[model samples]
Target: MSTLNIRKITPTFGAEITGIDLNQPLTPEQEADIVSAIAEYGVCVYPNTGLTDQTHIWFSRMFGNLWTIGGQGTRLSRFDYPHLFEAGNLTPEGGISTDEMARKRRAGDRLWHTDSSFTKERTTYSLLLAHEVPAEGGETGFADMRGAYGALPQAMKDRIEHLEAEHSYLYSRSLAGFPVTEEEVENGMIARHKLVHTHPGSGRKSLYIASHALRITGMAKEEGRALIKELLDFGTQPQFTFNHYWKPGDLVIWDNFCTMHRGGEYDDIHHRRDMRRTTVMAYPPPPVVMDPRFKDRFDPAQFEAMVDA
Candidate 1:
């Protein structure tokens, strides 16, 4: 492990880390340092030059168990890897989504939200790597929810401090007019999370509102949604965000627990935009220890031949 050189990109919570390569397996100490970096700063960018798909999976696994997204318009990043989700317009056979409704559903991603917020499992972090980028647009922006919470009025904070929000992918998909079946909704695609979350590592407070947060629990839908909108607008103000322009092999890792993010619109039809992401779970179940690869992991390791850091 080598010492890392970090440059803060934003005053509140984003940093660029240099002096490590993702292509190689990480030492335990290096993994700890990288994890610590994300804890202190809401986002960390590591240039993954010459990185392979396997290497990306290997590095991401060091953080924790990766979250697999299923159901409704999910295009797998790679057929062999279910943990990696494609964040682009291209299809499994390599073509863009031509359907306007399908494109709109993808476009709904433009709304600021945390990844996998609708899931029952806690999403700790997200590692996104740019494979192919466009000439312009397609920038990913992140909001400093910790900073957003810090700047809130005491009265407002008191009002929302203990409230919980019911998050649902069904609700968000509806916002984009993406059709879904009632059976899918009944399959348990909804969850409730604290409106405000405390980072386990630093014990700092953060506003956890997002587009997936459909309504506050036990409150009128309209009033709860209005409050959610208000908080999202406040958190995304320019002063609290850092908009990242992607470069090839640029790996941006963000702490999903303390921030909100969105994909920027680009020339998807004329220009191709390809990206891949692996989401790490915050509270994973105990590993099936019988599987050597999952020594202390939650889910069974996908590639057991690879060694853990």
Candidate 2:
């Protein structure tokens, strides 16, 4: 492995890395450098890597265990690869899907979020590869949560230091106007995570709130919503964000522990945009303690059993 041609895309958080061949296996030193880059800069982009589904999954596994689309099964999956998430507007046959569920899931991606936050074993990294892109728009915006935490007022920092929040994908999808069914709610897709976290890899404090974070644990629902909104707004300020305009063959990786991301708008109906992603799970959070307030909606025993395996 030779020296990586690293260039900072912004003063705060993103970097564009070159001189690495995604088609081949990476050396230990090369892997270390990439991990270091992620710790310091929340997002890294490799332009024109030309990674296919296999190579993309291979490169992602070099980091940690992958979060597969298992619970929902292959019914929602577009590609033959179960570990690779179909994040684009197209179907397996290379046509835009008219499925209502697929459309709503894409709509939920527009909100700022950290991948797998609503799961019991949250994800640490997300590697998104753009196989095809629209002629215009469809950029992904990333916000540095580490920087956001540092910029908070002392009082705000003191307040959220030991707080915890409840995250639910079922709830988040409903925010995008996806009608929730009784059966889906019975699946118990809720999780609990610290409101403020000390990232073990980077040793930096970061805000862990996202669109999936529906409410603060033990707090009034309205109050929790206000606080979560305020923190999200502050974290996603212009200075803390970097938007990546996609081009075919571009691979972008982001550390979910230190950042939040959202998909930018494009004419998905008119033009095809095929993006695939592999999520790496790491730093397993604490067990989800059932909240009595939401007992009617979630079963704690079911959540633990589903996640433990």
Candidate 3:
């Protein structure tokens, strides 16, 4: 592998990486260099990848294992790619969803959030490629959480240093006026993560505010929400942010731990903005124990009954 040419997209956060193609196999050294680039810069953009779905997935696997959305498969109706998820204006039926609820659900992506924050297996990195970019507006905005944490006042930083927040998909969905069933709330999808993430590889601290972060644990609901809003505002200031305008065959990879990204607004009804994403899981899910102590929980009959109920 030769020296990787990297240019700063923004002074604080994003980098444009050249001299690599996803369609071809990357050498071990090249792969490591890309990972190093991600650790150093929260987000990196590779222009003109022209990668097939298989090659796009292969490139993603070089970084880590793929993370799939629980109980959901590929959203592209025409495409049978299993390793990626649609992050675009198109519906599962290959048409735009005209339904209000579906539109509201998709509207939640415009909020600043990190992927898979609501799951137990944290999303390590998110790689998105644009195959069909809209003509007008389909940009993705990313904010630097590390720079956000660094800019916070000492008192503010001290206050949230040890705090934890409850992240829930239903919580963010409700914020956009999307309906949720009582059963869905009962079987809630939620996870707890530190308010400030200590980035493992980079050895940097980043404020972990997300739209999915419903509330701070042990704090009053209203107060916790206020805190989240405050942190999000501080973390997304212009100085610590970069917005990527989409182009066909462009790939953008971001470390979810140190950045918050959101989909940009576009004419959903007229324009087609087809984007696919491959998320690298932080680690695989923990193994299920089949000990007698956990017998009742693992019992198939009991699980079937619960599902029926």
Which candidate tops TM-score? Answer: 1
TM of each candidate vs. truth = 0.89, 0.88, 0.88
| lDDT tens per residue, model 1, 1-309 | 436789999875899999987787777888888888898999998875656667887888888787655543554444466667888878777777676876877866888998878976668889998889889999999999999999999999999999999888777776766776656655656889999878786799999878888789999989999999999999999999988999999999998889899999898997778888888877745632333432333446554644442
Which stretch of 10 consecutive residues in model 3 shows the poorest summed lDDT?
Answer: 294-303
Q: In candidate 3, which residue ranges exceed 4 Å CA deviation?
A: 73-77, 181-187, 284-309
Q: Is candidate 1 or candidate 2 better by TM-score?
A: 1
For model 3, residues 8-103, the per-residue Cα lDDT tens digits are 998867899898776787778888898899998999999998887777877887776565433453333445544578787677777766667667
What are the Cα lDDT values of the candidates? 0.81, 0.84, 0.81
User: Candidate 3 has what TM-score?
Assistant: 0.88
lDDT of 1 at 173: 74
Q: At residue 115, give the lDDT of candidate 1.
A: 84
| TM-score of candidate 1 to 2 decimals | 0.89
**Model 1 segments more than 4 A misplaced:** 69-78, 179-188, 287-301, 305-309
Residue 192 miss distance in model 1 (angstroms)? 0.8
